[model samples]
Target: MDEIYECPQCNQKITVPSEIDRAAQLELAELVHMGRRIDAIAVIIAKYKLGLLDSKIMMAHITAQKDTCVRCGNKLLEDGVTNCASCSALNLNWQ
Candidate 1:
C-alpha cells in the first residue's frame, strides 16, 4: 500500500510508494543484524539507481552472446576488467 501524508513545514501533500520488493528491506536488515558481510551493497544501490545493469546482463544471458559475471550476474560494463564490479566475480561465463 502507498503512504499518503502531508509535509510538516510546507504542508504539502506527499505520496510515497511502497517498496517494490516488500521483504527486501526486512531481509537486508536481518543480514545487517546477523553480522553478515554484504559485498554487493553497491550492486544493490546501482540496481536502484541504474536499472540497465540488470537488463543488459539479462539480455546478454538470453542471447547467449556475451559473458556474464558468475557472482553478480551482471555483464561487463566497465572496460579492461575481468571481474564484476558488483560482486567481484572473476569468471564471467558459466562454469
Candidate 2:
C-alpha cells in the first residue's frame, strides 16, 4: 500500500500535495504574501466538515478559483468577478 498522510485534526487522507495547497496554511510569509486568511482558515475548517484535504481545492472544484456566482453559484465569469451570467434571474441553482 502507498504510504498515506492523514490529518490529525480530522483523520482524513491528505490527497493533494501539501506544496500545492498554500491556501491551507494561509502562509504568513509576509503581509502581502498572505493567502486569503479568512477563506484559507475557512478552507481548513471546511476541509473536515466537507471531507477534503483543503477547502481551497474544494472551492476550486465546486466554484473554480472561487469564481462562482454570488447569487446562483455560477462560475462562468472572469476572475475577480462577483456576479454570474444570470444575476438578475437568480433562479437557476448550480449546486
Candidate 3:
C-alpha cells in the first residue's frame, strides 16, 4: 500500500510506499521549524545527499511597518501627529 501526502513546497500531491520509516519525516519537520532561510536550504542539501530526492521547501515571511515619532521611538497611531500618545514629542512620521 502507498500513503498519499501533500508537498508543502510546491503544493503537489505524491504517494510513497508505506515501508519508508517515519523518523526521517519527523526530522524534516524539525528542520523546517528552524525559521532560517539558509538552514532550510542546508537541510534540503543534506536530504539530497542521503538519496532523499523528495524534500520540502521552507519559507519565512515577516512583515514590518515603519510608523513612529522621529524624536521618540514610540509607535504612532493612524492619524499623522507629531506628538506620540505616550510621549509628547513633535516628530512623528507615518507611512
- After superposition on all CA atoms, what RMSD does each candidate show versus the true structure? 17.0, 13.8, 16.9
Best by TM-score: 3
Index of the highest-lDDT prediction: 3
Q: What do the candidate models score in CA lDDT, each in turn?
A: 0.36, 0.35, 0.38
lDDT of 1: 0.36
- Candidate 3: tens digits of C-alpha lDDT, residues 1-95: 75444433335444343443455444433444444545544554565332234332121211012355433456766442234465554321322
Candidate ranking under lDDT, highest first, comes to 3, 1, 2
Please, what are the lDDT tens digits per residue for candidate 2 over residues 35-70?
444554364454535343454333332232244443
**What's the CA error at residue 1 for candidate 3, in Å?**
7.2
- What local lDDT score does residue 14 receive in model 3, on the 0 to 100 scale? 41
Better of 1 and 3 by TM-score: 3
Which residues of candidate 3, in runs, are more than 4 Å off? 6-11, 15-20, 36-54, 57-95
Local accuracy of candidate 1 as per-residue lDDT tens digits, 1-95: 74444323233333322452445443433433344424224433444442444323322222122345534466656432244556554331221
Off by over 4 Å in 2: 1-65, 88-95
| Clashing pairs counted in every model | 0, 0, 0
Candidate 1 residue pairs in clash (backbone atoms < 3 Å):
none
Stretch of 10 with least lDDT, candidate 1: 56-65
